[model samples]
Target: MSAAPLTLTVATPLRVWFDAVEIVSLRAEDASGSFGIRPGHADCVTLLAPSVVRWTCTDGTTRYCAVDGGVLLVSRGVRISIACREAISGDSLESLEAGVRSRHAEEDDAARRARVEQLQLHARAVRQMLRYLRPHPGGGADGPDGPGIGANPR
Candidate 1:
């Protein structure tokens, strides 16, 4: 007799990506490495990195999901749950990979822009502070006796 299939549920903060679907097996990656899950496997929890998760259904067709890091929990040796910040699913690995790369590129660009903006803000703040500290253009001491030893103009 064939082993019972496991149920998979994937979700993000916004919505449920995949409801309970019966899958014969599953493959995912974590910091340690890739691992597989099947019915009657040990109940465990793992931290998944940004990688593709693949599973084979009872019909013998495979499906894929790209996750941006998440937590995977296996319960009762038959229930698999994945919670991620972002996830995209497709049957074609090539398309899935392309989509992931595009998403990552957009995120990187946004981060770079944010950093630039933050640096600009800091620069502006420093410039303002320096301007405030500087002596008045026409009134402040231009000679040593006025403000400091070097303030004296020859």
Candidate 2:
């Protein structure tokens, strides 16, 4: 039996899009750690972190996206909606690399380092999410199996 397909959509401020052209990635915090969702996926919602989001198209093409933080919703029909602060797609690799380098440089400062660390942590979380969302890259959802809701219980 195959899993349902997931429709993933990423949205951010229009201004950001105008400034940086790219699409962000999404991931699910499943009981198996993290898993990527493409077009066909089960219906459920999960919490997301500040990390890079990765997605593999049906053609076997993989894309990486960076996000600060956001929420992931998986509908019964396998549709995903991601609401995040900011997202950078693979197309913006240069800009994203610059941003990462800039953040890394800030690590030299004590105060700034802390802030940068926090941001980096968020970015890492987002990356993890992207990895999770990568189709079949990781094993089946292996974190905390549940209904895929409130994984990040507020």
Candidate 3:
């Protein structure tokens, strides 16, 4: 006898990847750990990790999706919805792995760029502060030795 079918939908920040797909089983990774979802399972919610979510289509074909992190909601153990920042679909495990690795590398590069920009902003702030606190060239009131900004009155 054929297995029962469950409807699946995966939504990301950009758009929806899956729309009412009929699947026989689902496998995913959450904070609690890896788990499986089958027809007639209890209704629940899971916080997905950066991993691949696999499922068996009604035709018995396996499919996969790469999710960085997100929430998966199951309603009545039949309708499943996933919300995430990023999600990509693949027809095979190898393709999913490649997609995930590429995305991970992109994120790392973006993070490095952000760190460099932050350091440059900090350097500019420090230079401006130094200019304001430095002694005036003419030893005027603004000088540190004078009775003005940053001056030491003894």
lDDT of 2 by residue, 45-152 (tens): 766777776765445555566777676676655566776777666645576777766665665676876888899999999998765444342334323343222233
Candidate 3: list runs displaced more than 4 Å: 1-4, 31-33, 140-147, 150-154
lDDT of 2 at 39: 43
Q: What is candidate 3's lDDT per residue for 1-154, written digit by digit as tens?
A: 7546899999987898999999999999998899999988899988999888999998899999988899999998788899999898999988888888888899999999999999999999999777667776555346344456745455
For model 2, the run of ten residues with the poorest summed lDDT: 15-24
Shift in Å, residue 98, candidate 3: 1.4
Leading candidate by TM-score:
3
Tens-digit lDDT track for model 1 on 1-154?
A: 9877899999999989889999999999999999999999999999999989999998999999999899999999999999999998988898888888888899999999999999999999998766555665654434333553224354
Evaluated at residue 111, the lDDT of candidate 3 is: 100
- For model 1 the TM-score comes to 0.76
Which candidate order results from sorting by lDDT in descending order?
A: 1, 3, 2
How accurate locally is residue 143 in candidate 1, as Cα lDDT from 0 to 100? 37
Error of 2 at 9 (Å): 0.8
Best prediction by lDDT: 1
* Pairs that clash in candidate 3: none
